[model samples]
Target: MNFLPITKQEMLERGIEQPDFVYVIGDAYVDHPSFGPAIISRLLESRGYSVCMLPQPDWKRKESVQEFGEPRLGFLVSAGNMDSMVNHYTVGKKRRRTDAYSPGGISGLRPDRAAVVYSNLIRQTYKKTPIILGGIEASLRRMAHYDYWSDQVRASVLMDSGGDLISYGMGEHSVLAIAEALAAGIPVNEITYIPGTVYRTKEMDSVYQGVCLPDYQEICRSKEAYARSVALQYENTDPVTGKTLIESYGTKGCIVQNPPAAPLTIQEMDDIYDLPYMRTYHPSYEKMGKIPAIEEIKFSLTSNRGCFGGCSFCALTFHQGRQVQVRSHASILREAENCRRDPEFKGYIHDVGGPTADFRHPSCEKQLSKGVCTNRQCLFPKPCGNLKADHEDYLQLLRKLRELPGIKKVFIRSGIRFDYVTADKDPRFLEEVAMYHVSGQLRVAPEHVSKPVLDAMGKPGHEVYLSFLKQFQTANRKAGKKQYAVPYFMSSHPGCTMKDAVKLAEYVRDLGFMPEQVQDFYPTPATISTCMYYTGLDPRTMKKIYVPRDPREKEMQRALIQYRDPKNYELVKKALELAGRRDLIGYGPKCLIKPGKGEQVSPGMQKKSRKKTIRNVHKKKGR
Candidate 1:
């Protein structure tokens, strides 16, 4: 069977041979290896199960199910990166823009496009197949998350999808456990004791309980909290048994499990790079001259896992851990060689990075021998004095890749921690990195401009990001290169009010950059900010303050950063007016929103009207 695309025809062809286990449904990007579904499949296969990876089957179509043959056991796993709740908005409303590109059709709604397509097909082809649902898309949405898409709190994926169980968090261990028990003839309803698994009660009245109550009051009580706290809170609860193994107050109970600690040795990391990848679209799509999105075109190579940079909005440190684990240099070089053989080789290596590209090896050499280091760099906002601060080894690896025969240019497309770059003892190393590794634009995530917000987000001060930008500019001028730093900014993050967003907009305007793109904070399940958003207090330090939970207010605050757009004038105006800051309007480059003179219409309002007209025109044409 075709492992990548499980088309209907292939399912019919496989009908003659019944597999020992079948992964019923869900989504997966063809490129992600470390993703949940892929990892679960690998683990089950290791246990001697003849598993079939049915990625993103068309669950909406009945014909799609008739293709896949019946199996001994059915498994349903989602694309691990996303939460299924996102689907309810995307699918239920038939919101085209959100649903078309979604991993799961319309966040967490029944007949989820992907699940419905696959489940319908299975029911038509095979009767009474036991289906299981797992992954971030299924896991976080396993409980009600404030669904911005639908603007309402919805039930967990188990309730919505009608799946046997909803497994949350890093699922390697839980998936293996479930497959083993099923293979041993255990009933699905009796397997609620497992960690990271969520199932309904026998009567379907409430979720079951296996573990003790988590300290929700403590964890969710704080106004400003870390992402780790939120993730830990959910992972700690076993929804099937309704027990909380990990304790914290104000936090919701969830089935929590740590990512396997058996760090992929450097050699293992290197070997993974050597695996073959499909670098181009299939022939059928290519013949029609259709190019895939950049995410689809780029060949992704993860040099390491986890991160020490505890950026609040980011879940990397929580999900992957702060300790850096690397693959061998030989393994990376092997992968580069393989890419050269592909027909689509363009001489440009997309990205060679992990959570933090400059951080190589663990923070300390003793971590491997000592079985985990308690270095405070991974925990607190303050930099550790004794922390290992060197990039010489990582720099050498980049140089070696440049020397390879097939590779023409290597770019560090993954984000670089500017503070780490400034901390490096070797000035020459920084010079070499700027000169050799950069493509046209180097992307650096400064996140926000306000000091309080940056601190709350667990990032270095604004000056550090500015210092690196200056140094990068100087280096580019000296080398006669035209490369520029692409500063990524986020608006409406925790602690960011209209004032903070305006400050960020001023900073952007002073830098003479009118950013066309900006990120509005997305509070996923198990994120610290999400709890703060819901509870109005930081979980770490029970401080209470106002959080902009209203979606419209958040969108308006985000719009302030793009003041140059006449289209945003009204949004900026409303945001500033609501915040009672009228002085910023009608003056300076930062002023995108023209202030209303007591009663006249604003430029932003006009733009909105125009947009509405265009949208109505399209509606009339049925385009």
Candidate 2:
């Protein structure tokens, strides 16, 4: 159960001549399932293949990637769990001071667009060796799509990095298939039939059962085409009903993305989590300080994969899909026992959840066989009548984990789906959560209080959130606990006008909570929200929506969310005035802003301005 080798010295010490794969990663090597590189590397090792990890190699130096020399099969690359662009920059598109995934929580360990950068670096040294790209960065950019940073539609990452192929999505099944093929002496260039992979091909003629997307040039020339293309890609994400998609890049050829690999069975899910993970960062990184990303998940257990919550702003639908595949309770309990034995165990299990904590199975039984609805959402607008809203399994799992010998507490901090919680016919789960699980407070994403904005965000309407809030409070009261519901709110989302921002400010003001943090909508790749932010039309409905593109207006929207702050007073006042609600700019109890100490303009100057307006009207009449 020790870590796979990361250096040539370690490889030789293990009696390995040439490694089977040289794994290049954007993040520091952490042999934990939470890290994508660890999963791929460990899985390869379990199959009797040698893998050497090259973490955060300096793209500037050719010797960095040369450390592993070359591998027998190929080199597998990933940009860690998070997209490098999202890692490097904030929602404001400003450079962040630290990278939590890096050793010492440092910045600049990996360059922006790390997958492409690392892939290109590897190609500089090994021209003919297979280069396989995976993880969030490569997965999201695996086709002709928009780049928020560059503010343009870029070609597939396979094209951008010149990588031989890309293994998208969770990549557990697809990667294994790829590894087997490469080990069997298949050339990387000819191995294009694997599902969940995107590859460049000159002959689209060989592709079957495919939908041809608009050429890159056509999409680039018209936002309409781009939206349509993105919509098509979105529809064909489910493994049960999806088709192979092909998009051209002029004379160079085309990029083909095969249908996603089928969801892992319960046994398979259990097997993946059962891998012998060291469950911590490499020991060699000890001197550099701890990897901050491990702090939350150090004692957490992932109970499931994929989400049916169907958040428009989320990339899970595109990556993990909508089917909920979970591990058996026996597997989770085993992980909990292992947690108890760790030297650092403090009698606390941080979380036991996945993309959404409360979801233990698919929203409905039919989803696994027939696929989720591509056009409509499972929980948004309204929870469907067919919704299998049950929490018996998750509740039982929590109870078992809590009753473990060394466990003092089990917190559900991975984030619970509040909407799902409210949909349950029984309130026992809510009451139990309030009594035991929460760590004094629970965080939920009711992104906003405005219905129109929530609709555009593909979130359940405001009433559902309000209903959930009441239940949360009532449960807390009955449990005699002083628990708080900390709602996460976002500002400047598409369809959020200044009027809506004011309404949100008023709602928070009534609740007597002025949030300290507000997210200005980030236009990350492949999400419906990102598409709307770029094209100014909702991709789901192709309807024009108001976007707060003006930098100052966006600032005002943010300020309005925290209107109580003195620094935001001016911005909030201006926003209120611009929304034609100047009545809200005074010291009334309902007012969002306070009045100034002095008049904005002299009475004489105002009279003169009024007279000049009259004169202009008379002059126009004379003309």
Q: Please tell me which predicted candidate would have the highest lDDT against the true structure.
A: 2
RMSD of 2: 7.4
Write the residue-wise lDDT of candidate 1 on 333-418 in tens digits: 77777777767677778778877877787666655564343323443364566467788888888998899887778888677788
TM-score of model number 1: 0.75
Identify the runs in model 1 with alpha carbons over 4 angstroms from their true place. Answer: 1-16, 24-49, 58-66, 79-81, 84-132, 139-147, 150-211, 214-262, 267-297, 365-380, 578-580, 586-623
Q: Give a tens-digit lDDT track for model 2, residues 58-156.
A: 989978998868888888999988999999998778899999999999999998899899989888889899999999999998987788888899888
- Alpha carbon lDDT of each predicted model: 0.59, 0.88
List the candidates' TM-scores in order: 0.75, 0.95
Report lDDT (Cα) of residue 322, candidate 1: 57
For model 2, the local distance difference test gives 0.88
